[model samples]
Structures are given as C-alpha cells and as structure tokens.
Target: MEYITLNNGVKMPIVGTGTNTYGKVNNDYNGALTNEIPELESALELGYRSIDAAIMYRNEHLVGRVLAESTVPREELFITTKVPASEEYVSSKDATRAAIDNSLKNFQTDYLDLFLIHFPIENKEHLKNTWEVFEEYYEAGKLKAIGVSNFEKHHLDELKEFAKVKPAVNQIQINLKQPNKELLAICKEEGITPVAWGPMKAEDHQKEVLNEIGKAYNKTGAQVLLRYQIERGVVVIPKSHNPDNQRANLDLFDFELTTADVEKIENL
Candidate 1:
C-alpha cells in the first residue's frame, strides 16, 4: 500500500476500507458482527492496513472485533474513527470526551491512529471548543492526529483563525462527477490531507470514461479512478464487499498516469 504524510508527520495509507452502511441494520452490533467481521478479515488478509470507521456508522464494535482478533500487530495497523455528528456531541466538550472514550472502548484500543470531527457545526464557538478538546486528547496520547470531515473553505477559515493546531485531514466526497477541485485546493493550501470517500461513483458515463482510461493501463474503471485520486495526492477509502474489488483498489501502484490522462479524468 502507498502512504501519504499528514501535516503532523504521521503516515496514513493512501487506500483504506470504509465501513459505512445504510439504515439501522447495524444497531444490532452482535447480529451485524457476522456481516463485517469476515469481510474485514479478508481485507486485512489482502494486505489492507487501514480501516476507516465511525460511531455514526454504528459498527465500531464489529470493526473492533476484527482488530481484536487479527494476527497483525497493532503497530502495523492504522485505525480511524469519527465523533458523532449530532449537535449534542458536536457542541459539547464533555460529550465529545465521552464519545471518544466510548470509541476507544469500542475499538478495544487505547489510542486511535486518527480521529476526526464527523462534520462541522454551525456554531463557531462550539466547533472551536470541540477542536480544543481534540488537541487535549492528542497531547494526552489518546489521539495521534485530529481533523475534520466535510468542511468547506468558510468552515476551515473559521477553524484556522482560532485553531492552535490546524486540522491534519479533511474527509469529503470526491469522484468523477464531483472532483471537488476548489475544496481540494483549500485543503492543499492549509496543509491538510484530502481523503476521498466515494472515489468510485458507479455512474454509467463515468464508468465508461474510467474504463476508456483504464484500457490504456490494462486496469479497471475503479482502479483508474483510485489511481487518479492517488496521483493527485488524495487518500481514498473505497469500500467493496467483493475480495476481487478490494484487491483491485490496492493494485494502483503498478502503473502511472500521464499528465494528459490525469487532466482528462479531471475534466470529466
């Protein structure tokens, strides 16, 4: 797997496995345990070192179970989880503290490789206070790095003004349809690593374009899309239940895209 160095000098895998699911099916952590455990183990067996999870995803316990049983050493794995997106948690320092502690308990680990604000709250004071809490945890060794997800330029601007430590990452949706060029530029300017969540959108036209591009490299549409993001210095967490697809996501290092091909995809 390839790696990107965050502003804090920590190495993050460029590709990770995402664990978001629709509906409340994940509420039964025990029932859903069967659903993700094998797949996560399969991902690890296929050489995935990073696991992207969140409390809102409602499967941290399941993800934790995989980690608890994995043969891979803890030091070799990079685990990330997010705070709850609700206003109650996003606006309260005590609530945020309880949330992170719960995540730690759920993950069965003392320190998270990375933790991020799931989303930006409208209240600047609340957001800044929450970030300050993250900084405290970071200093206390409960979190290695702190960041935000789904933050726009205005949101980042506000955070930067009062932030003692700038966010290390900004997780957002990026795909062929929405390249998010402007947001990426802002992240680049602020020394934040851009992480693409939906790297492959599966749109018919987009897939066709990606396939056409992949034809030149003897790869698939998904592979081409992931390669495009990696070429642009964006970390991607492309999720797939299929082992073949999971393997393909990580098979981007063997080929390189020329400037022309990169621009072609960017223009799409």
Candidate 2:
C-alpha cells in the first residue's frame, strides 16, 4: 500500500478499510453486533493495514479484538478511530480523556496511529476543550496525530483561531455524486490530507464511464473510482465483505490513470 505523509510527519496509508458496519448483523450500520468479524479477518489476510473506525459505530471492541488477535504485528498497522462530538465524549476534558483511554484499552495498544473528532463541535468552548484534550493526548504520545471529520470550511476556520497544531487530515465524503471540490481544495491549500469515506459510490452513468475507463486498465469501476481519488492525493477507505471485492480494492497499485481520463472522470 502507498502512504501519505501528514503535516506532522506521520505516514498514513492511502487506502484503508472502513469499519462503520463491520461486525454488525446483516452488514447494517444500525444492526445488532455479531460475535465475530470475518470480513476484518479477510481484510487482514488480504494485506489491508489501515483500519478506519469510529465510536459512533458501536463496535470498537470487536474490531479491536480482531486487530489485537491478528497475526499482523501492531507496528505494521495504521489504526484510526474517531471520538464523537456528543456530550458523553466532548462534554469535558476529563470525559474526553477517559474516552480515549478506554479506546486504547479496547484496542490493546499503547498508541493509535490517528484520532479525530467524528464531527464538528458547534459550541466553541466544547470544541476548544475537546481539541485541547486531543492535543494533550497527542503530546503524551498516545495519539500520533489528531484531526477532524465532516468539518466544513467554517468549522476549520473556527479551529484555527485557537489551534496550535493544524489538523493532519479531514475525512469527508468524496465521490462522483458528491465531489466536494471546494473543501478538497481547502484541504490541499492548508496541507491537510483528505480521506474519502464513500469512495466507491457513483451513479450508473458515472459507473459506465468508470467502467469504460477501467476496461483499458483491466480493472473494475469501483477500482477506477478508488484509483481516481488516490491518484489525486486523497486517501480512500472503501470496505466490502466479499473477499474478491476486498482483494480488488487493494489491487490499485498496478495502474495509473491518463491525464485525459482523469479529466473525463472529473467532468463526470
């Protein structure tokens, strides 16, 4: 897998697996939890090292269990989890600290590769306090890098007013349906990496275009979409339960998109 160097010099995998629905019943985001996650095991076996997890998903312990028990050593893994912007987590500094501590325990790790606020905190004080707690953990070496997810330009502006450390990444939805062009440019200008969550999503017509483009490279439309994102320096976390699809998701390093093909995709 390729890597992107964050502003703080931390290297993050350009491709990762999203675990929002992993270990859930029927692969539903709101489904009941299952005792095991074969998909995650399959991902590990397929050489996926970057894991994108969040507290709101409600399955950290199970995901962590799989990671901790995997044959892959902890050093080779790039684990990223987010803290929600809710009262239970961001109400106070101590509460935030406790939440992170619990996450560390659940993952059975001394340090996480990256940590992020799941959403923007509207209240300035709460946002400040939460960020300060994140900064504390980062300084203490518990969190290698800190960042925000689903943050818009205004929220980033608010963060800059009091932030000593710039955000290392801004995880957002980036697909043909929601190009998010402006925010992506902002991230590029500010030196923050953009992590695309729904990288495989595309309309049928768009998929047709991607498929046509993929034919030349002997790849699938989904692979084409993911390749488009990573080619432009965006990190993608595309998840799937099927082992073949999982293998296809990681089979992105073999091809490159032509400049005209990239423009065609951008215009789509």
Candidate 3:
C-alpha cells in the first residue's frame, strides 16, 4: 500500500476502513436507529492497517478489542478519530485534551496518526480553539497530525485568518458522483490532502467507468474506482463487512490505471 505525507510529517495510508456504515452509534435521527457497528477483528484480519471512527460512532471500545488482539504493531497502523460537536460548534481546549486521552485509553494505542474536528460548528473561535489544543497534543506526542472534516472552502478561508496550525488533512464526501471541484482545488493549493469517503455506494458513480477501465486490466469496478482516486492524489476509505470486499478494497497495488483511462473515467 502507498502512503501520503501529512503537513506535519506523518505518513498516512492512502486507503483505510471507515467504521460507520449504515449505523447510528448512540443517537437516532427523528425516530430511527440502524444496525450495530461491525466487528473490528474481522476488519483487522482482512489486512486493514487503518481504522477510522469517531466519538459519535460509539464503537471505540469495540475497536479497542480488535487492536489488542491484532498481530500488527502499533507503529504500523494509523488510527483517525474526531471530537464530537457540542453546543454552538465549539470545544474546550482542556476538554479536547481530555478527549484525546480518553481516545488513547479506549483504542489502547500509544498515539494517533490523525485527529480531526468532526464537523463545522457555530463559532470560529471554538474551531480554532480545538485546533490549538490538537496542536498542543501533537507537540506533546499524543497525536501525530490534526485536520478537519466536511469543511467548505469558506469555512477553511475563515480559519486561515488566524489559525496557528494549518490542517494536515481534510476528510470530505467525494466521488465521481458527487465531486466538489472547488473545495478540492482549495485543499490541493493549501497543501491539505483530501480523503474520499463513500466511493462504492450505489449512489456513487456508475460502474460503467469502472467496468470499462477494468476491461483494460481485468480488475473489478471497486478496484478501478479506488485506483482512480489514489492516482489523483486523493485518499479513500471504502468500508465493507464482507471479507472478500475488505481484501478487494486493499488490492489496488497489483495494477496501474493509465493516463487516458484516468481521464476517461474522470470525464465520465
């Protein structure tokens, strides 16, 4: 697997597994809840070195269980989590620090490869405050890098006016179906790597591109889609509870997508 370097000098895996697939951690929207989060041990055994979860996911303890039993060393894995959005979209520095501590204890890891503010909240001060606290943690050795998720370009520009530390990464909803071109350009220009989530859902771009591309290489639609993203310098986290799917998610190393193929896929 290939890796990307964060602005802070930490190596982040290009592909990871997301834990919140069709499930609500502890909260229900309006009146509905969903399936239980998947077992992490299955994911770890399937060759996933990175696990992405959030406090809202409420699966930290479950993730911890797998980490303790896995054969992979702590240094070889990358774990990314986020701080929950409280009232007014603001967070306390001390509280954020405490949250990091709680995360370390929950995941049973010595440190985190990445920590991001989950969502854009109300006050800009609170957002900057959260980053400041993360910066402290990064210096103190609890987190290797810090970033934001789902941030619009305007939100990022607003933060840049006074941000002490620039984000090392920005996780967003990106795919051939819902590509946000402007935000992507801003991230690339600002030196923040963009991570693409929800790539294989039915709602994603049709498999015609994948199928056509696969014809040239004899690969699956999923493999073609992931390779396309990584070729564009975007990180991806495609999740699956099935063993074959999980292994397929990591099988992008065997083939290379051609420039014309990439352009053809991008054009469609």
For this target, which candidate reaches the highest TM-score against the unseen true structure?
2
Best candidate (score: lDDT): 2
lDDT of 1: 0.86
Ranking by TM-score: 2, 1, 3
Candidates 2 and 3, the one with greater lDDT: 2
Tens digits of per-residue lDDT for model 1, 219-265: 99889888888988999998877788889988999999989888877
Segments of candidate 3 deviating more than 4 angstroms:
22-39, 201-205
On residues 1-268, what C-alpha lDDT tens digit does candidate 2 reach at each position? 9999999999999999999999999999999999789999999999999999998999999999999999999999999999999999999999999999989988999999999999999999999999999999999999999999999999999999999889999999999999999999999999999999898889999999999999999999889999999999999999999999999999999999999999999999
lDDT of 3 by residue, 1-268 (tens): 7898877788888989987642443433232334344445667777788788887766666666667667888888899988876842245777777888888888888788888888875587777777778888888888888888989988888778877779898899888777877888899999999987786643345786677679778888879988888888889998876778888889898889888887877786
Enumerate clash totals for all models, in the order shown. 0, 0, 0
TM-score of model 3 (CA atoms): 0.89
* Candidate 2 structure lDDT: 0.95
Q: Output the worst ten-in-a-row residue range by lDDT, candidate 3.
A: 27-36
What is the overall TM-score of model 1 with all chains considered together?
Answer: 0.93
